[model samples]
Target: MTSRPGGRSARVREAVLDAVYAELIHRGYLGMTVENVADRAGVHKTTVYRRWGTVDVLIADALDHTRETDWPVPDTGTIEGDLTAIATEIADTFTDPERRQVPAAIVAAALQSTRALQAKQAFYTARHTEAAKVVTRAVERGELPPQTDPLELVRLTCAPLYYRIFVSGEPVDRTTAERAVQSALAAARTGLL
Candidate 1:
């Protein structure tokens, strides 16, 4: 099926991203090629090259697009509640089989390529920045201590989830996520974080 030129840009991007994601899952990072993604997307190789310029950029963009959209950070006026919300979101993404594999490939690519590392850093920076705002709000509400480090808190809250997703290869559920959040909150309350 042919997509309209200007009217289907967003749709075309989504199709390309989906194709790239599938290729990443099946072929792994090292095996993924722009030609393969282009063929899978039913778009020309030149179109893919013209749009993304490089395979790393294309893959990074696909990974970023798959992440939860406009997910609001929780601000329930309690640090525990906010952490719980954050943990829930993390668990939801990690437990999804397709979604889980994308990050694994991205991390593998990042370790081997400077461009991938930079792209991953930029993506995480934006995500953590948003998360920091939530922590900042909690601090303002007196839920967390005045000197609480927002970035550290964000890391602490997500460390276990990432560990489980990447290392343990275990399913991340609401229960597991809640535990991570609870652990972070406990540590924070005791000045550990």
Candidate 2:
């Protein structure tokens, strides 16, 4: 639809994305269908077929869009603060009822499908790209070693939170998030990164 201003196409796209997200959250990736999404979005099935053509592409598009809107990296002054903010954001993502299930489903879908996996990787790559700035800021401030790998550090910082959700299935809270921040900070301070 090109995202042009004041267009019904944009509205329809938004509705389709909204329907896609709701379906992913409530029914999961496998349960998601173009017919169901079209019905949910109040559009014709042919419209969905003509626009996206498949559930895989629609799920990937919806996921990529969510990553653009959500998962913003915080620019708190210190590395610890930044890491803490990142961890908190991750925790909130897992715990927030409005968001929790869909991501879990997306992650699972990523494990099952190449298309979903590429979309997940792209979303994480973009998130880490923004988050890398925090590590760069820390290095610039002399808080980190000059050779620190920003994206690697960002991955380490997020891994625990993802583990909690995708592996342990444990509840993530502020305290859990803080522990992850502290652990990463400790390792970082020791030049382990």
Tens-digit lDDT track for model 1 on 12-81?
A: 7988998988887788777789999999999999999999877788877875774545757677777788
Residue range 27-61, candidate 2, lDDT tens digits = 77667789999999999999899988888778877
The TM-score of candidate 2 is: 0.86
The residue pairs in collision within model 2 are none
Best candidate, TM-score: 2
Model 1 misplacement above 4 A: 1-15, 22-32, 49-54, 63-71, 168-171
C-alpha positional error of residue 156 in candidate 1 after TM-score superposition, expressed in Å: 0.3
Q: Candidate 2: misplaced stretches above 4 Å?
A: 1-3, 6-11, 26-31, 67-71
Q: Which ten residues in a row have the lowest lDDT in candidate 2?
A: 1-10
